[model samples]
Target: MSSTTTSITCTGLTFGWPDGTPVLDGLDLSVGPGRTGLIGLNGTGKSTLLKLIAGELTPLGGAVRVTGELGHLPQNLTLDTSLRVDEALGVADARAALHAIEAGDAAEEHFTAIGDDWDVEERARATLDQLGLVGVGLDRTVGEVSGGESVLLRLAALLLARPDVLLLDEPTNDLDREARQRLYAAVSAWPGVLVVVSHDRELLGLVDRIADLRPDGVHWYGGNLDAYEEAVAAEQEAAERMVRVAEADVKRQRRELTESQSKLAKRVRYGNKMSANKREPKIVMNQRKRDAQVSGAKHRLLHEQRLEDAKERLDEAAEAVRDDAEIRVDLPFTAVPPGRRVLTLRDVELRCGARATLDVHGPERIALLGRNGSGKSTLLRTIAGGLPAVAGEVETHVPVRSLPQRLDVLDDDLSLVENVARLAPEATNNRVRAQLARFLFKGARADRTVGTLSGGERFRATLAAVMLAEPAPQLLMLDEPTNNLDMASVRQLVAALGSYEGALIVAGHDVPFLRDIGVTRWLRLDGELNPVDPEEV
Candidate 1:
């Protein structure tokens, strides 16, 4: 990949949904040869922008131009399950041609197909291995790999293509810890123009720059996530200070307006009294009255304008400060005694060939960690009763609820209020609305159908339904809860989890998040459950 020449540029870009919901408008961006992290809240058009650049979707206006060949890995990847690994990687024809030539078929077409890439097979295998696809062979079907591995396989395909420009959307969302490390390495080594939209902090830290998408426009920051955060924090502080100054000016202007009005009224009263007492000539008194009225009116207008100007300044300053609200809730009923048994898994053998016996007591917070295809999600599903275990007993002493990675708990056609109501039938409408409000879905927001909600909104609604279910789940399980969530949404999840006083079994690759939620026990699955030190993970 060339380092100096490749680039992606968008000019006067504008886009809107079919329903007339506008997204980007007159947006212009220039990405040079380097790793750039694209980040924003869910629905801020990070993915949409990537799609436009990748030519997956046409913009409503303007144009996108790339200086070199491009490869894209979208957030939602759909590949044919019957496709062979080599076919999915787009090397099946070349591989076949090379084999035919090696078998002594000296055909012109085979030679053309093989071209100068005689080492295509070795490169493919090496790319696979580099991405931690050790056992995944070219002959294996796509259906034979796990979901996380499938993501890596697609990334491997992109890498083998060797395009000068690459775009990845939430690439690590499906990857496990080890696979994410491999991806981080690939991203670090990318020498051409690269733009990735991701919520993974570790992945963002590998970038040379950050493109933060906001409603106003894209704001560029020089460095990684931490650097962007520090820059933003300083900006917020300055904005806040400006807001305070503007507020004080507004107050002062209001006070001055009031004082002027008071003084004007007093003058009016004195003039009337003088006129009534005949203290001066009639004509002179009339002239004095007229002049006083005109001066007072001018003074009042000036003060009112000052107040208005101050208010406008205050509004402007306030706009500069972000309001990323977090979730806050109290779930006292979900609390468990210190000695109570929450869950017991006896000799549990998952369908993915992992076996473990686990006992969760009290409010133990457990982190389930593993590589891709290591059966973490499988074990979670088995314990959640969504999948039957191959062997052994799974029991929960208290009510259990699982928040799956896909967030399939809610009906898309139904509104959030309706979904939560279905799960908590005994709760009154007002009660459900109150709780939903805490989840940041207030009033009409809660009435919107789940299908219309954004990823973050859907996550919050699903979590609300599960945690606020009728029986009050004292044992909660979440699988990859932060997979596609934005940073704000991740913080909201942490805040919501903070209020849950129940035993938790969270299976995820986000170690920072797991630690933030206070995971008391670290368990790694590798054909068996093994205790891992928190520091090691």
Candidate 2:
């Protein structure tokens, strides 16, 4: 690590994805040598910015200069298959160069850059201990670890390299709350220039400053997420006031100029009727000319200036503009047609693996509650006709659509439009585009591969396809719709679900979201379904 403090500075640096819309515009940011959390909505280029700083991506314009060694975890992690935890930190590369140096090979420069380690296994074991993987065998295979565990191991590998600058993207997405706490604690103790892109509000609150990258440009506030939001909110109000004042001044000036012009025309016409010898003095004529130019020209100038000022104000105010008026999509038939036999689960027992049984019934917004691997997903899968029951009967209505948590229903290799089109083979591209627009995926965005979309976008697109089917599914099964959504986006989704008709059997652990969406039925993962509780579900 560099002894001197390292910093990341960008000047007019901007970039976007390959063959994608412009995500950044003339962005400038100066990051001090400390942990700074990146905050932004989808397609805001937060992930792209991290890649620029870490040297994975070259800026399209200007520069991104980081004065230190850098290491990064991309948004997705692809591990070296079956590699032991101890051997995963590029130690083999470190050792091979050491051997080459001793043999008088051309790896001299590599040896100079990477110090010869005492022993590869020793170094790897030490890194594993530091990362809270204390008792796990150093030689354990990566394939044996769980998804969250694998994430922790990958992060540990990056941390072991001891880069002067560390960039992490959505580091906590797969980990549990406790694991996130453990990682955060380690980050707090590290002495490096840290840059992280994440949507976790708690993580955002821990940063030194918050940088928001919107479509317009990039802006940073020297505070936490809450403070940044408050500042942005204040700017929104100030910008609105600026626009209103400029508009009022323009209106007032134009009206006065119109009246003044009328008077001037009358004066000029009357003066022409007078005899040349008897006309007013030259001084009066000059004064009148001066008055006309002052009022008329001043009006034009002020009017033009105000128009420009108003446009600028509008641009700034657009950051938090409430264009999406909370139009409560009033459900045409808010209540489902009460059928005596909505669903029938006869002695149906769901056993995911070694243990776990979950049973539930119809017209229910049943919330399947559990931690990771608690059989919630397995139970929901069976309900959606994904898994075969061991020994039971499960019956549901026709035309059923399910927005699974992972969207297993969606074809990863297919484009979003194609995936939606599978349900209606005759659906034209224009029709598919219109349906996708309601969920905000519109146009070319719908043409992107379904596997490439972020979690939230995928969920929205899946939900859109679900609701737009020919015979709208009377029974909708949603499994953790709010899992990857940011707070604002989650709220928007809850509103959409609230407006949805049909029988919803949502499986989520978000109690507050369940209450807000008017869920009346609750099903515990361990037992049969029950009515929603006033206090807890």
Candidate 3:
């Protein structure tokens, strides 16, 4: 916690995948005690950097140094279902020792275990309560908690440790609104060196600074995400201006070169006439021709070099400007009539015992809001016919498609084009490939197997397959659609959703994403489907 000391440092750090794809090359970073938000596009090694700092991954070269104890919360955290709360918090032994002593056991080993941490249980409970896990008891098993609760429980464990350096990657990916708020509060109150990599704007707003990771290295920007964005915007504006100026200079130089060539050609024709008519001495004519040739060559070389320099400057300026592409596709076939009923749930009982009675009409876009394990996904799966309802009847009057959180819609061994073709058998190979290109998979990229694609790419492929099915789904249901997606992918999803003319029922924890997709109604799932205001969500 010293003002002058750095908590984590990396010097000449290097790492790459087994396929020799370099992620970080000779990267040097130094982090002091404060909250720092690490951000970049997907596959930019943001998570990989955190793992190296936490010693979870070994770097190919160089070194990572930490001044004090470090704690890390990974993006995909899986805990044993049988693990008790106290054990997960790392206080089981201390709690056992304290209990044995209180019961009059007085064993030497018990006393040794207690050491000076007799208040560990109290601290653990207090930490859990701070993270909004109020009713969760130490004796409870991991399976008894919801997905959001499990994430908070892991964060609670990290808080109890009180490590000097803390690293969190995509901490709010699966958290509901209330849980995300609790996490934001915890991050604001932390008094150590904390580095978090997340796409959640609200979470990034809590950081004191931003560390933008790029292929070259990390670029530091003071203040939170908004501040960083403003700075980058200004930088991009300047870069654009530079590019324009460089382009104009190149054009002007080319014009000058052309004019010089024309003048030189005229002079050569006049000189040839003078030599043929004997208008000058032979030696003078030969000397004059030699001089003109040398001058012309030098002039052309100078102009060409200037044009090349201008082009290089233009390229560099363009590189400074970010170009994040969005998905653009139209699915007119998915449109439904205004009076048509897309889906009907007739007193339906979900797999998780939740009941619902609703009718979705026309192109209504519904946002399903609920805490983790609240049966939102179950209802979507039931409607998609992936799971049978416990009781009652569910009917869909139009073509339906469901995109699950696990992204299992495509075959791992099949190429992206092949996957789309399988979903829409009537569409020819050329047609499928053309549609896939709009999803940002062009040519060779479209031929990549599903298993070899990155998380964002895989999501795009799955979405493409669902939306481009043979029947063109009129009732589309998505479960946690934004989970594990990068910001670019999320924007692409929003773009795709904006063009859909069919009914939509998307269950997710991302409020910003839901709002961006133009949700017409908000429904909260508990024991039944209840209408709620978007503000409440």
Top candidate on lDDT is 1
- List lDDT for all candidates, in order: 0.90, 0.67, 0.88
| Candidate ordering by TM-score (highest first) | 1, 3, 2
lDDT of 3: 0.88
lDDT of 1 by residue, 120-211 (tens): 99999999999989999999999999989899999999999999899999999868878888999999999788999889989999999999
lDDT of 3 by residue, 417-454 (tens): 88998899999999998899888888887887777565
**Superposed model 3: Cα runs more than 4 Å off:** 408-433, 443-455, 469-471, 535-537
Report the error of model 1 at residue 96, Å: 1.1
Winner on lDDT (2 vs 3): 3
lDDT at 223, model 2 = 76
Clash counts for all predictions: 0, 0, 0
- Over 92-186, each residue of candidate 2 has an lDDT whose tens digit, in order, gives 56665656766778655666645656465566677667665666675578776655567778888787688888888877655654567777776
Q: How many backbone clashes does candidate 2 have?
A: 0
Candidate 2 has its poorest 10 consecutive residues by lDDT at: 322-331
- Candidate 2 at residue 276, lDDT? 52
Candidate number with greatest TM-score: 1
Off by over 4 Å in 1: 1-6, 426-429
